[model samples]
Target: MQYSISQDQNGTHLDWQHKNVSPEMIDWFWSNMEKGFLLWHPEEHEPLQWVIPPKHGNLIGAVHIAPQTWSDGKRQNLYIRFEDFNSVPDAIKQYIEYDHCIIVAGLGFGEGSLHVKEPLGYRIHQWQSDVQNSNSVGVIGKSNAFGWKKSENHEQGMIWAKHAGTEISNWGLFLPQLFDLYKVVKNTKYNPFMDLSVKRIDGVLQYKTAN
Candidate 1:
């Protein structure tokens, strides 16, 4: 998809033309793209700030999130922390104090085109409780086996995918290289796991329905 941006008296504007694209989809695309551009060029955009120290030891990654206004005049923000779920530090939890947050994690895959089925877990209990405290909010997981409560309030919700394709691909491609780089930089042992726990659920659904 191609997109164009223009600025006028009425703030900045974005225009895009693509077949079979809905207005809502276009708005979502534009919003994410704008946020991504701001993230990629942090020097140019000062909206996103690093609230915690980045991991520089065996793992080389950083955490960054940006707050922006939604079209409905409501404030919303996304949090991104590029580190192992198990290795997240406590200091960074303060940055994710938003009323609504979505925690997306990729469940690793195992053999036979099945989800790895690891125990579904969250790093911060306070946030989980906060989400629960808000009666009008709840969490949703791709796999219902996860311990997320269902609620009537659909307006505010959190979703987790059993196997997020983009995240699996990203970790699959980046982790090996990162491990190798870490070994060389820190003079440590390198253990690479080529198993990417991901499968396309759409195809599975179609096959099941057809069969």
Candidate 2:
């Protein structure tokens, strides 16, 4: 599916429509993202594990290390740190509608020493609560999830936007099914028996539907 990309003084913007996204999907994203990410987009994404798992089980201050294949075909390792939404400056907050939204921010960096390397940029993702468990929430701008980096050129920004849009769409497609399996494990005393596999259909890798 093709997603739209636009630009303004703020930065490059991408608008994607992911239908039937449930609250369970959101819960899965925050908690089991390391697993779900590869399941959703096996072609593009590499394994992303937490370098610093959430302290006290809260997302704020958690850190993850991952590598991304850029549009330029260069793979770069990224160290990302999640931050509190309240710390966002007013200038950026003005453009975001925070009411009833799951507001999240991440500080991104490329390879090299943590203190020595310049920051890649900040990522702000805000999703409306109402969009969850709703159908036909078409083109909701608040659900747009992509990082707008300060150092990236317009071309690079668009590439990232497109990549994010594709990833988000894939998650929306398979999350409900994945969430059902997750509930089974939770209910059955953490049964370690899951027969999940990825299959390629029409050149896109996707989770095989649970029988």
Best by TM-score: 2
Give me the runs in candidate 1 sitting further than 4 Å from their true place: 1-36, 39-46, 53-61, 77-80, 87-153, 157-211
Per residue, candidate 2 scores C-alpha lDDT tens digits across 1-211 of 3347777655666554455664335544654567576766666778897776653234555577766685678785677765444554544545554222233434445434344332345655544444443454322333433344445567777777867776767866777677776765643222222112234456433323322
Give TM-scores for every candidate, taking all chains together and pairing residue i with residue i. 0.24, 0.69
- Cα lDDT tens digits for candidate 1, 1-211: 2333333321222222222222222112111222233433332233654333232221112334445443334453434333342343233223233222222222222222123233222222111112323343222111111222222122221211211212222322333333334344432122211111112253221001100
CA lDDT scores, all candidates in order: 0.26, 0.53
Candidate 2 C-alpha error for residue 43, in Å: 1.7
lDDT, residue 153, model 1: 21
Per candidate, the number of residue pairs that clash is 1, 0
